[model samples]
Target: MTELDPVIHTPARLRIMTALNEALEDGDEIAFPALQKLLDMTAGNLTSHLAKLEDAGYIVVAKTFAGRKPVTRVAMTPAGRGAFRAYRTALLDILGGSR
Candidate 1:
């Protein structure tokens, strides 16, 4: 049996990673506000989970200015993509064994 990634196993974190994995498949970063709207998560809650994913080196958060307004963008790192793939494989393995 393969072990699931603890960092991404949490429901919120999983949702975050899943969203990033799908959204960023085009190789584009997602703005913080857009991500929040997509996930339907409050700012504080999203921030908390983002912190964990960032700490794990699974995502990169870039804060910059768009003209006069500050903008935050998030992207999944290469490591994050790999981790997410592994996590999915582990989940599939678990489910496959049940049948």
Candidate 2:
């Protein structure tokens, strides 16, 4: 017996992973506000989820200036991309390909 990697299976985390993975494949990064809108989550909720993903090395958050305003962007890490794929596959398996 070997211990398995900690699984991030929470619904919110799952949603975040899915969204980040989608954007990465499209060669685009999602803005914080857009993610919040898409997830229909509050600022606190989004921040908490983002922190969790960032701590787990699943995503990277970049803070930069967009002209005069500060902007935040989130992108999936390589490990995150792999894990998100596995997560989707696990989900599909559980639902038997119908959901």
Candidate 3:
């Protein structure tokens, strides 16, 4: 069995990563509030998960302002995409054993 990445194995984080991977083009980003809405997560909860991903160097978070309104965006790094693909392959292999 392939080793699993603990950083992205959590349920919420997995969902966040998967959503980001699927919904946006590589190197593109989603607004924090948009991600929260898409994932149906509360601000604090989403922030917590994002912080973990950022610490792992799996994702990038940018904070700025748009017309004086604060804006936060998140995007996956290339390393993150690679990790996610590996994770998915491992999961498939593990599950494949059941067939």
**lDDT (0 to 1) per candidate:** 0.94, 0.78, 0.92
lDDT of 2 by residue, 2-74 (tens): 2223445888888788767765564467899999998899989999989988998888888999899999998
| Most lDDT-accurate candidate | 1
Candidate 3 structure quality by residue, lDDT tens digits, 1-99? 577789999999999999999988888999998999999999999999999999998899999999999999999999999999888888888788431
Lowest lDDT block of 10, candidate 1 = 90-99
In model 1, which runs have C-alpha deviations exceeding 4 angstroms?
A: 97-99
- Pairs that collide in candidate 3 are none
In TM-score terms, candidate 2 sits at 0.79
Worst 10 residues of 3 by lDDT: 90-99
Candidate 1: pairs in clash? none
Cα deviation at 86, candidate 1, in Å, is 0.3
TM-scores of the candidates in the order shown: 0.93, 0.79, 0.94
Stretches of candidate 3 above 4 Å error? 97-99
Clashes of each: 0, 0, 0
RMSD of 1: 2.1
